[model samples]
Target: MNRENAPSTLAADYARAVDDRQFSAMETLMWPEFTQQGPGFSAESRTVFIANLAVLRSFDSTFHLLGQVAGEWQGDQYRGETYCVASHFFQRDGRSLCMDMGIRYQDVIEVRGGEARYLSRDLNVVWQDEREITAPILG
Candidate 1:
């Protein structure tokens, strides 16, 4: 595939893997020494990254993105942006309250031995709900 097509293709596959909670597919894109950060390191480490998928899977409701690409791939690497929104509901204050959050993903992909691997991914906060929400990063 062409350089541009490569990243878009990767993005599509990744979005699906994420929405489906298929964390194993991440191994296909993540390099052993993957170092991901841009404005904020989304996950502390690869292990932490994988662990979050479990949290995601446990959520009662989640709304993750239009699955669009906001960046491009260059040379032997792919770089792009992605988005995801997830929500959870529970009984509180005699009513159901939802916790919602949005993740803006800025990523880098490196192709090795004919496979595209993740070099880095930075996820920034875009939005949050107000019902017992966690502290938001205001930087």
Candidate 2:
């Protein structure tokens, strides 16, 4: 694949990794020097991104309310944003509560050797804050 097309490949792989929940595979999709930072996230390096899956899985296992690419575009470099939604259940007090949000997955990525890889990403949770006083209303 040409160098220009590499970015798309990387983006596609990332989508696959998320869909399959292949934590290990997802690890290979990012560069070692990746530094992720944003308003609410401060993840640096690939290990930090992939390692958190275990803990997340212990609490939430299903990705619900998923949709299409939503939006896609590239700039001078291999940088773009993809908006996606995943309704996941959060475990609280031995109960499962579902939360849905329209997330803007801002990613700084690169393509090398025909494979696209992530350098940094900020999962901009466009909605919802910590479930502090936000208790789920149930009977």
Candidate 3:
């Protein structure tokens, strides 16, 4: 793809990597110095970030729906914003519950060896909701 579309694709790929529990993919998507900041959470280095992802294993499933994504070249890096609705599913007392978080990711990326990867990402949670699931979850 073109350079202009690389950031958006990278954002979506990150969501998939997280949701699918493919932590190894992060090595290719993030720089070694990658850092992540989120609500009450912060990690330095891609290795630390990948290790921190173990928390996601506590959930039964997760789905991150990527929304608007836009970026612009800034000197030697690209700055972008990615909107996402992240849903976390789990069972509590034999009832299914879901927690949905409206997240905005402020990202910074730099291309290395003609491949773009994240240098840093800050996750902002604009809103959140939690409710019981009434419909059956289908695969």
Candidate 4:
């Protein structure tokens, strides 16, 4: 992959890792010092970040759709922002609801030998919409 495309690919890959609940994949995607800061959440290390992801299990499913991904290389690190719409579906109070959040991920990635790994990611939620889901998720 070209150096310029690494940031975009890294962002999408990380989103897939979260949606798939594949914590193991994160080890390869992030540096050991990886930190994640978001609304009501903070993790200082990759281990802590992965451990905290267990909270996602409360939801039946989640889908993170990436929109705009733009960044540039700054010395050895790449800094960028990724816009996303993340939907979390779950049953609450005998009713199914979907929470969709517009999030912007401010990311710093370290590129080595033309490969990229996340150094840090700060999540900024631009907006959110929660509504009941009348349609079936799987059917």
Q: In terms of TM-score, which candidate is strongest?
A: 3
Question: Model 4 — TM-score against the truth?
Answer: 0.93
Candidate numbers sorted by lDDT from highest down:
3, 4, 1, 2
Find the candidate with the highest lDDT and give its number. Answer: 3
lDDT of 2 by residue, 1-139 (tens): 4555555555666666655678788767787877767555566777776776564565444453433333233543466666666555667876557666677767676655655577777777787533423435679
Residue 60 in model 1: lDDT: 43
| Predicted candidate 1, C-alpha RMSD | 7.3
C-alpha RMSD between model 3 and the true structure: 1.3
The local distance difference test score of each candidate is 0.65, 0.62, 0.91, 0.90
User: In candidate 1, what are the lDDT values of residues 16-109, reduced to their tens digit?
Assistant: 7876768888777677666555343356566667665686655543445545667765778777777767455545555556676776777788
Q: Give the candidate order by descending TM-score.
A: 3, 4, 1, 2
Which regions of candidate 1 deviate over 4 angstroms? 36-45, 87-97, 130-139
Model 3: ten consecutive residues of lowest lDDT: 1-10
Which residue ranges in model 2 land beyond 4 Å of their true spot? 1-20, 38-40, 64-76, 90-96, 129-139
Query: Candidate 1: which pairs clash?
Result: 29-118
TM-score of each: 0.66, 0.65, 0.94, 0.93
Query: What's the count of clashing pairs in each model shown?
Result: 1, 1, 0, 0
Q: Candidate 2: minimum summed lDDT over ten consecutive residues — where?
A: 64-73
